[model samples]
Target: MTATQDIMNSETLMGLLAGWGITPPLIEHPPLHSCEDADRLLLNRPGTRLKNLFLRDNYGRRHALLLTRSDKQVDLKALSRYVGWSRLGFASADRLRRYLGVEPGHVSMLALVNDREQEVELWLDQELQTGNDFHCHPLRNTATVLLSKTDLQAFTDHTGHTPLWLPVPAS
Candidate 1:
């Protein structure tokens, strides 16, 4: 069995947590190479886990860091209208890296710190707030951080980014 202790030593996830004075168990697994893998990983874990999506509107005038349930299907139209954007789509991995300073598989909210300019607007699903803890990448794919929702909010606030909480309609 891969122990949490083993995973905690990883440079990317653990290093970030240590920098933030935030300590959380590191869950190691087969590389979570995609959103589908992330969803499956969350199923076996006990707390709330999010699927982070990086997007830019068609005009390149707006950027967003969208947080949704691992299983929730995002409706870009609803997102665009709610955010008062005319059209929005996922940004390319290269664009995400250029803007957030994170690679394709490691795109995470934590990467916002690297984005000192705050180019991407942070958005969270209402459901995610209900949980005591939410798992997110610490700027890497090899591990994930399971920290309190309050901590995450505090981090966002400290970063000087206003997060938009949007509730998805019943499917």
Candidate 2:
């Protein structure tokens, strides 16, 4: 398959995780487009729910996938200054599909598997590095997978993307 054709979907991601002997807990739910949706549907699920943002520089020459606590209010202006990026803004759905191989609502750290060219930078909230569990989409918003920090690190290492851990600025 061509590189683009090789982009992972939910099944592929699950298979990859299985191959790595890492089977995280999966919870099926209605598609979640926002934190509110998740909160309403994912009742009683254990983990620190995540919010993933696909962002781009003003010129669109650089892209980043930022992962943080779902409840944190992120200030884009302060985040830009903190990261030393040039006026970061939400990337378009087209860019998200092209780089992360996921739709806007399906954005997740696992989608970094599709970034084979390493074109999209990975930014992680340092607060999430605590040994707590994390809730994430397995390439689709229809379900959530509960992963530990070790599982996430193994997946990241497999994908060859090094995450820049930093403090996410709250609004």
Candidate 3:
């Protein structure tokens, strides 16, 4: 079977985690309209959550999976220099679809499933690993998946994508 057959959508991501012997609390809510909605929904929750950004370099030859704290303000210039790329900017919806095989508003590492051929590089904030819990879109923006930090690291490792650790200092 082709790898495309194994694309990780919401249900599939949950099943994949289950198959991996992980059973962390999975919270399912209505489709969130924005990051603010997710924050509000997860209010009073225990553990850290994140905002995942899909970016493209000026040349469009380089794509980055930037995962950081939900409240952190992205310093584009600093991030670009660290990644050794120029003019890094949010990728368009079409680019997200063409490269990550995911529609806009639903970008997540799960989308990386479609990039089995190594089309994009993953960049995770070093701070993320300091927390035991992390949350992200479950292949859809309307919902979020809460899992242990360790499980997320394991999942990323399993994907064979070497995540570049980027530390964003507090402003």
> Which structure among the candidates has the greatest TM-score?
2
Q: Write the per-residue lDDT of candidate 2 for residues 1-171, one digit (tens) a residue.
A: 134467777997899899987899999988888888867764778778888989999899999999998888889899899988899999999899888888889988889888888899889999888736788889998898998988888988888889899888889
Error of 2 at 161 (Å): 1.0
Backbone clashes, each candidate: 0, 0, 2
**Superposition TM-score, candidate 2 onto the true structure:** 0.93
What do the candidate models score in CA lDDT, each in turn? Answer: 0.73, 0.87, 0.74
Candidate 1 lDDT, 1-171, residue by residue in tens:
112222222365456655777777777666776778866665477677677889899887778898888778888888777777878788987777666777787766777766667788888888877776777777778777786876777777766778889885334
By lDDT rank, best first, the candidates go: 2, 3, 1
Off by over 4 Å in 3: 1-7, 40-42, 169-171
Model 3 pairs whose backbones collide: 31-142, 32-142
Q: Who wins the lDDT comparison? A: 2
| Candidate 3: tens digits of C-alpha lDDT, residues 58-109 | 9888888888887888888787877778988898887787667777777777
Task: lDDT for model 1, please.
Answer: 0.73
Using TM-score as the yardstick, the better of models 1 and 2 is: 2
Off by over 4 Å in 2: 1-4
Clashing pairs in 2: none
Candidate 1 structure, TM-score to reference? 0.82
